[model samples]
Target: MKKNNINDNDIILEDLQPSHAIHLYEMMQDDRIYTYIPENAPAAVETLKEKYKMFSKGSLRKEEVWLNYAIYLSSEKLYIGTLQATVQLDKRIISIAYILDPKKWGAGYAKKALSIMLQNSKEQFGHFDYYAYIDTRNERSINLVKSLGFKCVEYIENADYFKGSSSNEFVYAKISNK
Candidate 1:
């Protein structure tokens, strides 16, 4: 429930705004980025605009909060991707998700951004469990989260029922000792 803007020396994580749609649309144009995600790459900026607006409004349920951040590179001065956390207030649990422009892959930006986001989440929510649901075939994402200490807890079958396709996914989680 605290303010969501997060910043580090190299990256800026800001609340998703309507104006970010164009940049976000550009980021999503690459088919490689959406290979494991539920939806295909967005075909139009309008779709991104609508999505951003909904994200800005956030969740209405009192105990649930949905936060989305448009990732910006401070050095490059560009909007590159998105990172989000869906928080369960009463349970103090957080589910983290993120996507980066495929062009920016192997640059370690996702790792840095996630580290900052996780630290911020812990500071804001105190002790909480972290979770990430990754497509079973997404080796990159699976390794990324695992490198961050998330362990696979469940194998979900045909769980990604989006865009006319069903794919299996794995639930990765880490319980905070705090």
Candidate 2:
């Protein structure tokens, strides 16, 4: 794959790098950010290293299906968060996921990163639709996606919650290319 620079008024989407590990780890340590995300554990230096190694190997695999991006502040070049998309090759659809640093939550970085991912996915993978699975109680994230024109299509009741509490899973979708 190729790396392309995605610039917005305040943030940039760059190709993921080993150098971003520390910043990502620090961001993931915030309980607010990792609370709803089940797959993301508390990010430690060692965990970051292992994840980077695994991602490297996964990227090289012929059957690998995910694309990951690192989000940064364009002005200060600070790593802010991550965006990931998985392609369903058979269905020609892409599912998107992202997490922004809790420190920067109200600043619109997540929306910018998501817009870039949607555009890039259309250009590179010919994906016309974008989908996301978000916890219903994550009002910020749900609002963010809705603000981007994603419509909530359905809700899966009592979905798998990371913590002990039951949480509704909302499925949101948007047409990106067509």
Best by lDDT: 1
Q: Candidate 2 lDDT, tens digit per residue, 1-178? A: 5556677667777766666787778777778876776665644788786776565443554443677778988787688888888777767667888878898998877887898778777778774578899998889989999999999999999888667677779999997655
Give per-residue CA lDDT, model 1, range 10-87, as digits (tens): 898998887899877877888888788767776689988988899888889999888788899989998889988999
Candidate 2 residue spans exceeding 4 A from truth: 3-5, 39-43, 59-64
Stretch of 10 with least lDDT, candidate 2: 55-64
- Per-candidate TM-scores read 0.93, 0.87
Clashes (backbone N, CA, C under 3 Å), per candidate, total 0, 0
Alpha-carbon deviation at 52 in model 1, angstroms: 0.5
Please give the lDDT score at residue 13 for candidate 1: 90
